[model samples]
Target: MAFKVAIFDWDGTLVDSVEHIAESLHQAATELGFPALERNAYRNIIGLGMVEALDMLYPGLSREQMTSIREGYARYFFAKATMPQNVFAGMADVLADLRTGGRGCAVATGKSRRGLEKALLTSELGQHFDLTRCADETRSKPDPAMLAEIVAFYGIEPHEAVMIGDTVYDMDMAQRLGMPAIGVEWGVHDREALGQFSPRAVVGSVKDLRFALGI
Candidate 1:
């Protein structure tokens, strides 16, 4: 049977924001006089929110420093976050195809509302998705809150939706809700990491995603 709804992860899955994200965190770390994070370090935390990423990067810093760093990152990230980002190849087409096929699409992301809106609008892919569950409105990734909220909002059972993302957090959330999940390899996480979550299928590109969904 076709899925009734599709819930997606934002950063790495749909929009290629890893470089922009890493740069923001690096700038924030520098502003706080903390060690700058390597791309790999930031990559590992791709599914987490900005504040949470800062907290992980500067674990030894005091709460005050964390808060300050988070503020600095928000300022830096918002200023240039959409610059390096673009819709992953074929993702927009896939979303459009899904929409045409009468499946509803939503985003359940760790991004703040402003950040999510900027990325989606700037990338010109916002029109395809029907709902957005941002970090400000729900608990962070790896938590089922965002996914659960989307399911509830659509009045659909967990099985009626499939969460598509590139991170284990997405898969974990799907598992928690007993929903099917498809992992994309082109995103931050590799097959090995995604394999640990045992998603229903691991796709290498956005084009493959359609097949994974059995479309």
Candidate 2:
């Protein structure tokens, strides 16, 4: 069946925020006197929720410490007012094409509700998505709850939706729901890593992604 909904992952998938995210994680760990993770280590956990990512980065932390780290990460990430998070090239056009094609567009991201909302406002891309589900509000990526909820909200079956993301977590989540998933190369994980989840297509550029989504 033709896809009726296109669900995207925010950070590395739609926007080029990997450096900011890695920096935030490093800064958060440093401020807390915790061992700072390497850039690649931070990148590995990009698709996880803040709480989950912190736990993986600094195990055996108390609840208070976790909260502090989360706050510190947010502070560092959003501190530079001039730093603009740019959407992937041609992605705006992809969203517009999807909209014009009568397909619903939405976000299923590991970011907190507040973070996602801030990004939408900052990027001025909120108008493109019909709905958004954040990790903090529901189960994070790798869990099917977020996708399941999105599909239900749109009154569509899982098969009618396609997940476009750059992580194995995103692909796995869609797989759990029996939904098709398309992987993007410009994100956290490489094509080989994402391929383990058996994505329908692993696109290397926004142009290929547009074709993959049939937009």
Candidate 3:
């Protein structure tokens, strides 16, 4: 059966903002005098919430440190706003095709609600998705609640939906919810990392993703 709902992970899957996100975190850490992690280290946490990612990156933070870093990151993240134009080529078209095929489109992301809203506004891609779930609003990725919410919103079975993302958390989230997953390697994780969860397909490019989805 064809997928009825297409759930996407925002940073890597829809837009090429992985670097921007990582840099934002780096900028935050610098301002707060926190030591920076390697670039890939920051990228690896792309699909987790800010707090979770921060805790992982800077363990044993006081509430004040977490709040400071979060706000600092948000500032740089917005100030460095070229992301709307960074929407991956063919992604908008893919979304249009999916909607035309009577499929519901949604987002299951690790970004905050405000951050996602800002991205959606800047990118003007908000119209493409029928629904969106952010980490701040619910459980983060690898926990499955975000994907489950998208499926529940569309009233579709797990098999009737496909989660597309660039991270292991996305694949693991889908796996936990019994939903099929498609891994896009252009984001954070590579084929091998995303593959272990048994994604339906691990694609390297937007065109390949179209083919993978039978679009």
Candidate 4:
């Protein structure tokens, strides 16, 4: 195998939390007197951070309103939602295969630290990942800080690592850090959007991910 380390994105990439996210976004929007987004619109915002997603939803919202909406969203999310989300069909099997192959794996997500813990614990996917970097622990994506942190923590050179994600933020960060990225098609963004970051390749399914690793 050409890669020793693999890093994944949490939200739309590994887990299908779009329904929970939309429900929470709706609750927050209603509280803020803003219109709730349709499922598709909210899905488009899936890979972005909370602030960025809210900004897109209500562009004219004041900073204070944004803060309130975000807080409300988190409250609703934690109270009304339970995750492990919906594991992308073959994700668990693929992860297990990777682990068994002696590849080191981790996660970098915009999800809060606690949210990540809850999701991992619920999914029982924690055993597959060696480390997890969440928004609370590092700067949000598109910043490269999280990716850099993961690379450093794993003690691997950037080239020895591959980021697998479904968004431009993930791909762009990999690009910035001189690492390879494989974008997922069945995620928040489509191939065109992911292509903007020039990932090494675009994977249409979990089975393809094994090929991405030359398994």
* Candidate number of the best TM-score: 3
lDDT of 1 by residue, 1-215 (tens): 36899999988888888777788778877876787666789778878876676667666777788788778878887886453337777888888888989999999998889888888777888899889998778788888998888999999999999999988888888898888899998888888888787788898966678888766
Per-residue CA lDDT of model 2 for 1-215, tens digit only, reads 27999999998998998888898889888977888667999998998888788778888899999888888888998885312348877887888889998999999999988888888888878899999999999987788999999999999999999999998899999999999999999999999999998889998988888777766
- RMSD (Cα, Å) for all candidates, in order, is 1.8, 1.4, 1.1, 2.1
- In order, the Cα lDDT scores of the candidates are 0.83, 0.88, 0.90, 0.83
Clashing pairs in 2: none
Better of 3 and 4 by TM-score: 3
Backbone clashes for every candidate come to 0, 0, 0, 0
Pick the winner on lDDT between candidates 2 and 3.
3
Per-residue lDDT of candidate 3, residues 73-106 (tens digit): 9888888664556999989899999999888899
TM per candidate: 0.93, 0.96, 0.97, 0.90
Off by over 4 Å in 2: 81-85
Clashes of 3: 0
Better of 1 and 4 by TM-score: 1
User: Positional deviation of 17 in candidate 3, in angstroms?
Assistant: 0.6
lDDT value, residue 51 of candidate 1: 65
Model 2 TM-score?
0.96
lDDT of 4 by residue, 7-96 (tens): 999887888876788788888888777876677777667666777777787797888998898888888887844444478777888888
